[model samples]
Target: MTLSPSETARYRRHLTLPELGPAGQERLKCARVLVVGSGGLGSPASLYLAAAGIGTLGIVDGDRVEPSNLHRQVLFETVDIGRLKAEAARERLLAINPEITVVAHAFTLRASNARELIERYDIVLDGTDRLSTRYLVNDACVLLRKPLITAAIHRFEGQAMSYVPGRGPCYRCLFPQAVEAVGESCADAGVLGVLPGVLGLIQATEAIKLATGIGEPLIGRLLTYDALSLRFAELPVSRRRECPVCAEHPRITALEDTAEACAADAPLSVRRLSATALRRLLVEARRSGPGLVLIDVREPWEFDAGHLEGARNIPLGELRGRLDDLAGEGPPIFVCRSGRRSLTACAIALQAGMAAPAHLEGGLLEWVAAIDPRLRLVAG
Candidate 1:
């Protein structure tokens, strides 16, 4: 399709580039990119892709904006807190580039609808945060033979990679099986607010490169970024001959939900206790029995910042060795910045034969949100 007068004026800088000339711009104008998740990573990714003139941009998200999201999810404003993310993102993208078509799939991407949604787009961008969703997206992209640009962020680091079906390694090739231990999300681990913006823009760059056929994308390689150190590293990835998906004779011919897989890997004894419930437990124990032991599993630095008044600090890595130290204490409640490391601590306590220890449902984050609004929930 030929560029219109307004489009030419809008993309004059991109058109003038030797690598991505008018023809490349036309390719971008004809591309259909689907971004799954309108959260931190998806926010900047969709914005830049829309600004770059991707013909049709589809955003899939079932969540509504929250006040907490305002820090990193740049697509929405304070007024948009209760609004659906996909819808809000569409409005924002259209305001930025009215010429492009923005489609909002304001629902969660599930195995039942993943193939249908992904097949509609030329390329898929994995902006979702869950391990189950990431695996599902990877398997679907591999089976449908679609290019996928994926990115993930934790506290101070993030990684991005591209999977071009037969051209490079799929996500499963690099990670043969899901590691639930390392699956802590930004919500759980506490991410640097600006980290996703940097990584999301990188995802946008790779998508644009794939659409415009520009410089070599991060296919078959993982690009990792460290926000604290400000360092970028590229790690080579090789296709596994025995990979369940994208192999010579693939074992997985159909899509499978990864919820069961993740669940199977999770510890059975790790139970979640909401902040209100924990507070009640403490109150009840204090009234009639020995008080409950509240253990803060975050590092000393995190503990020094702010923690529950009576909570004892026991970092997760040191919890295993200190199991005997808490043998005779009341039922322990593990807490962390988010709840991830606390869950690990609970598991460790249980493995050491501690009875029914639980982690804070959302860690100290929930505590700050529910029990004590005055406490500051710091993000790393």
Candidate 2:
């Protein structure tokens, strides 16, 4: 297809680029790219691709725009909060490039539907934060022979890579095992807002370059960014012949949740102790022999307010680092406000092979309700 009369103005900058003249511009117009996650990376990637006149832009996101997203999710506004991210991104993107077709899927990408959705696109852009989703996207793209431009952001750091069909190493080849959940999400650890924007733009650049075959792709290379130092590093990657999906041996023939598989490998640290047994232990700790070390694994902010009188304080995120402090050869009764953190801490302690520590069956809330109904706990 020839450039439209209006296209000359819309993509004049692209036409001037030696690598992306009229011919390359036409290829972009004929290309279809599916971008996963309409947050941060998705927002910028979708906007730039649409602006560049990509023929069709497909967006898949299950989350909604939140007030917190306004900082970096450039495609959304305060008014768009609560609206599905995919729908909101489509509306904003079309407004930028009405010439392109913008299709929005307000649903999560799961194993069952991944193949069908990925098969429809020429390339897939992975902007998801979750590892499971990333593996799903990579596997589906490989099975369908679609190139994948992947990016991930954590705190002030970010990584980007490109996966070309039968050429470069897939994500699994680089990260053979799922990493333990370190509890440092953008929400918990906080982000600079501009980090995702930078990473997303880079992801978009990879997509554009790959589509036009302009520059050497990031295939088999991992680019690490340090927003704090304003420096970037590129690491070499090699394809694994033993990779379950991409390897020659190919142990994994069908689709599986890579992220979940990783998570399952190092499952949550907390396990349940029978309520009856816990109640009996609580009596034992209060009355006689070996005193139970009641530990509160909540944030200090939560601990200062009120906690069990004799409880030790160690936030769950930092628990793994402080395991040595708890290796006193006695059972510790871990407690948290709702039991979630405490349960998690107990799991960590147990995994460290600490003699199965106990959780205050119902946590601090239950401890107050049952053990000391009249205790004045500090309010958060």
Candidate that would win on lDDT: 1
Candidate 2 lDDT score relative to the true structure: 0.77
lDDT per residue for candidate 2 within 329-349, as digits (tens), equals 587777776554565566566
lDDT of 1 by residue, 1-380 (tens): 99999999999999999888889999998999999999889999999999999999999999999999999999999999899999999999999999999999999888999999999999999988777888889999998999999888777778889999779889877665555542333355677889999999999999999998888989877686778768785555668788888899988889877753332122333455778888888788778866668899888887888888778998877888888889888778898886756765765665466766777866778788889988766673
Native RMSD of candidate 2 (Å):
15.1
- Estimated TM-score for each candidate: 0.69, 0.69
Model 1: which residue pairs collide? Answer: none
> What clash count goes with each model?
0, 2
Model 2 backbone overlap count: 2
Residue ranges of candidate 2 with Cα displaced over 4 Å = 258-380
